[model samples]
Target: MKPALLLLLLAFTAFQLALCDRNFPSIFTGEMSDFNIETISKANSIRREYAKKNNVANMNKLTMSFHLITIAQRLAPECEKVRPGSIYRYVLLKPDAAAAAHEENLKLYLDYTYARNRPLWNERVRSMEQDTAYHLEFLVAEQRQIGCTFANCTRTVRDEQTLEYTTINYGALCLLGPERLFQGDRPKWYAFDEKKGDPGSACLQGLVNDDGLCVLPPPQRGVTRIPKPTYIPPSTAPPGTAPTKLETDEINDFFLFNELRRNWARNNGVSNMWRVEPDYDLRLKAQKLAAEDCEKVWPTENYRYFMRHTDKTNKEVAAATHEIFKTKIDTILHEWDRKEFENAIFRLEELDRDTASVMEFLIAEQRDFGCASASCARTVLNPKTLEYQTIEYENLCLFGPSGKLMANPPYNYSRTLPPFNQKYGELASDCGPDGIKEPKEDGGVLCVRKIPRISIEPRKPVAQALVMIEPKMEMIQITAVSEHSLNWRLVAILVCLAIMN
Candidate 1:
């Protein structure tokens, strides 16, 4: 296929979606129980589907392919070239490393037309982060005049004489003053008006003497100076009062981190910092009365037993006295998650025992069968010791060493092996080429071989034998019977059943 069946890039590249299954944690039961695990779980499976759709890697490859096709069309403008509105299939390929691999890279197939296509380079090249450079959005935002409007602020202009920005005092902001005299205001000079000179024209008006010489008017005396206003602007705080602090915008604390941390911090009431320092400063001196609470409670150590009380009245009063607050940080989730996670370190028992099994719909399970070159999850249960096993993931893709399938490729999953059918044992085991599919030329992990038959010490049918049945039993490798031998095996099974009856 020139243009292969196209699987687009995934949505959330970093999302590690856990397998959705009924195998939930023990605490979750049903709706009638204390909590309905289903409510939270509904969001999980959705993540899987959403993420695959946004897969960055796939998107990058597709973009490369589209660009290539576009370039081809532009280059070969003659004839039909490529149809304008046709959909083409595509598959992502690993980038070629040896070539220029920059704009010169081309490993994807061009799909200018719906049905006609060819490998991008036929032999050309390929290329990770969609872009290498980090372009700060904040810088771009800074370059824009987003905050101030021309109505409230004057446009900055350069001074003609100095070739620098003219200084603006904005005295026009005063209700009593004339407009700030910008360059628009012209100073007009007038001829001597000896008879009755304009009092306001001190700079322009002049006098004529007997010699007919233009004598500038003598400097006027008693020019009254305007004193500074005692009244402050309403926007400024009064001299006697302190300015209030700026608060962060009240977006929803639906962020949950603060609440979750605070929940973890409280015991019936006292704050940990107050418990330790007794004199912790909360900077509420103006609003609240200062008290030496820590000194008073230190001797008695009352906070130790405060959490033991079950009554609401005592807790409420304690909360009023010892309000707790975590030191806020700047980053989004990383720091908050770290501090909250620390709550689990000291008190594992209080950790949420119930996991919301909401991911069930978001997952795709091979269901006792999966094909991959590697496993994200490798579960091992200890039957003798009865130990718990950590759940692992199913690798959507994997790599083998030196251009070969991995030693333990995902083409390996637990499957049942047929009883050694002497005449058809090989067929039943699916050890032949016909049994399992191979990797396509385009590339996909396929079943290579089933694990060899496991041997156990022969024992009498009635005797208890150590039967090791898994990682193979009910598991799939290259394990299944051929069609030709399947009928014979079925007949043999029928004969054995008849004899038993």
Candidate 2:
């Protein structure tokens, strides 16, 4: 053989050897197993491997979320046919299906906690809301599919013999397992069919070459249309308060005005309406009083004095007053002729601006965390890392599971940040109080938690033999923590192959 050809062959051999030694294909395969394992020990092993690859003391929320996404891709029946970010969005926005098993266990715990004091009436009432249960189910089922493919691929393909079968993993979500809810059904948010030809479309055609690289679908496509919800204005009267006689005209006009305003707002690209507050107590009080003296009141029987008098046998008078007040609302709406309509329209515009201000404030407030927001999850589990940490006042992570300190700068979440575009999609746009700029092009930031760090003595090599050390049994005990570690390892292996090759 020629010297040049021999050198080239040697390099290829080295590359192939590296893949075998490090379990490259297994990373994706193992991720699939990580997704389905009920055993906590195995999960911890996987997560620990994943964590070590990143060299971070602990996985961040977004990393955890990515694992779940990885798992979902594997287990998700329609994962391949679905767009790239579709399953990710489905898990974060809706993890009912994937999380079904965990949620069911959670439900049991909750039931046990509340069993003693819970009223049967409450249960009966809850049963009436089937929609709520369906929504929850959707989340669990979807969560089940997250990060599944990575784990499964890692475990299955660790042996080269099975590498050929692994190509089945690539494709649109619809090409995966059981029929997905969205397979035949078109979702309003995801424009899968619309972007079939668009390069940015999440779903890409799965193509397998003799060389083993899983081709992902195209990038997101089209103008990235996101439909905003229509806002309905509240009544003018205060909440729980019926309209007082003076506010009757205002309340009556509100209903009619809202009808016209909504249509106009839709056309004008301003659909959010401001809520109107009305007084309920005053209206009820007047109604109760009028009802009690209806038969005794007469229209001409000193009605005005009867309203104010303490002692008056003016049941006839009371009746007259009630009729006059009843006509008040009628007069307001009917008498509104064209002139009143014009004035009401003018007032509505001003109200719309006020509504916008209120909504903006609400949108800003949503940035604060410890829960899932449109932007990120601070209170709830981090979708990326699957780790839960306290959200500081400025939308920063304060601590890790081992209580390692991680402090980020005080940031205005409302502003777009690098993480927004990369990690969070609509949420980044909707909730921007967390001072992150546009999502970084690279996606995640590598901020290590320096406090409460654990120092371990470097282990000595054992005659070229790899040391197989299991993570402390305790870590695997926790399902989430373990799952995270496993997911980390699988992702690391894939990443390593991509880089080295």
Candidate 3:
């Protein structure tokens, strides 16, 4: 053989060997085994190898997230129908189920490849880098929590040689999460300085070196775990105050808005979404404007606003005002979720800028806000019939002192600097000075901001008095007009009697 040809052949063989180092006796079959531990361990080993090769510090060991496991289970059914296309397309089809997952990797082997002994699970995990460098969930240093599962499936394909259809069995291994990493045209690797620090000195907070791999230290004994309640009722009116239904609703809205923002920030690459407290002044102003009618965007010089409209029934309006304000708020949020705003980046300068999209609610500078809702029946002239009709409308408005809904700036000051920029998952090291690392109920840690005490007083009763007096004055005028007519009639009768005498 020619020397050049032999060298090329050797290089190709080496590449194939790197792609699959270990071979299995047969295809994956039978019921799935509990490979969660093995999967996580092997994945971390690969991560450590990559880090060492790149001269970067090893990231924290990947832990299994049940949240991602549930998502993996959902995808397990689709493995049978897997085709040669983007795996993310399948995930995008079910946005709600997969919203929390940041990335997915799937390794599939058909009958043709099965003839040449399939690769073992660990080998597949190791080959992830060689298989597709862009979708390297295992190699990406930012991803820390993972959920993996295997599926065996069979499908019918036409044999090209025989020109006949044949049934073939296939096996697939799937992995999901660490959540916050956004997969784009190119992979976003963990930022690090090459060969600048000691082997383990580059490890972030909440992580330590476990041998060569960065890992979370074992939980200390005797530590108390706080029991999280499933549900907490909204606050009610104090003793003699008139219902305070609006106040209760505002309180509930404040909590829901902050919770949604926190969840999004934690799952995205955002690090500085401060806890939004209820501002009484903002709430009163929003409520007053909403009550007038929810027709168009109400832009104020000092505040940003998000408004939503829904068709509602009289019963819904009454119920919302008296008892189910939280339900109404939930419905409005659901409407926003249905829009799937997280799927893309939208700028405030987009063609349709009047209405605020989900991006508005996610502005990092939005520190405090208030929400208000109003329901009314509007009379509109039907375009076709030229007849006036009453239409029921429900409007929800959220306003804050800051939080402009512009495009995300190119640089984020909140994100941690190099060597410690991994912000999501179990070993997140990006909590700022006032933030506390708190474990999420599902899995992973969140940098919870320490909210300072706001000394603003409760909403003054002036606005409430103004709302009350309008109706009362109308009632008083109606009574006065009736009494004046009655008095005039009595005087006319007395005048007639005097003329007759």
- Candidate number with greatest lDDT: 3
Q: Per-residue lDDT of 1-501 in model 3, one digit per residue for the tens?
A: 223323332333333233233322322322232455555555566556555544556455566554344345555676555321211211111111121111111212222233454454334333332232222434455455555445444444444334466554433344443333333423333222223343445565435776555554443333212123122222233445553657654544443444444434543445555545566666677778776665654555456765433434444333233222222223322222223233222322331244343334545556556667766454544444566555554545555545345433452332221111123333224556766544455123334445534333343342443344334323322322221122211122222112111
Can you give the TM-score per candidate against the true fold?
0.13, 0.18, 0.38
The C-alpha stretches of model 3 lying farther than 4 A from their native spots are: 1-130, 133-243, 298-301, 307-352, 356-360, 376-395, 408-501
> Which pairs clash in model 3?
none
lDDT of 3 at 185: 25
What's the candidate order when arranged by decreasing lDDT?
3, 2, 1
Q: How close is candidate 2 to the true structure, as a TM-score?
A: 0.18
TM-score of 3: 0.38
Residue 103 of model 3: what lDDT? 19
Sorted on TM-score, best first, the list reads 3, 2, 1
Q: How many backbone clashes does candidate 1 have?
A: 28
Give the runs in model 1 whose Cα sits over 4 Å from its true position: 1-99, 102-286, 291-332, 335-501
lDDT, residue 456, candidate 1: 28
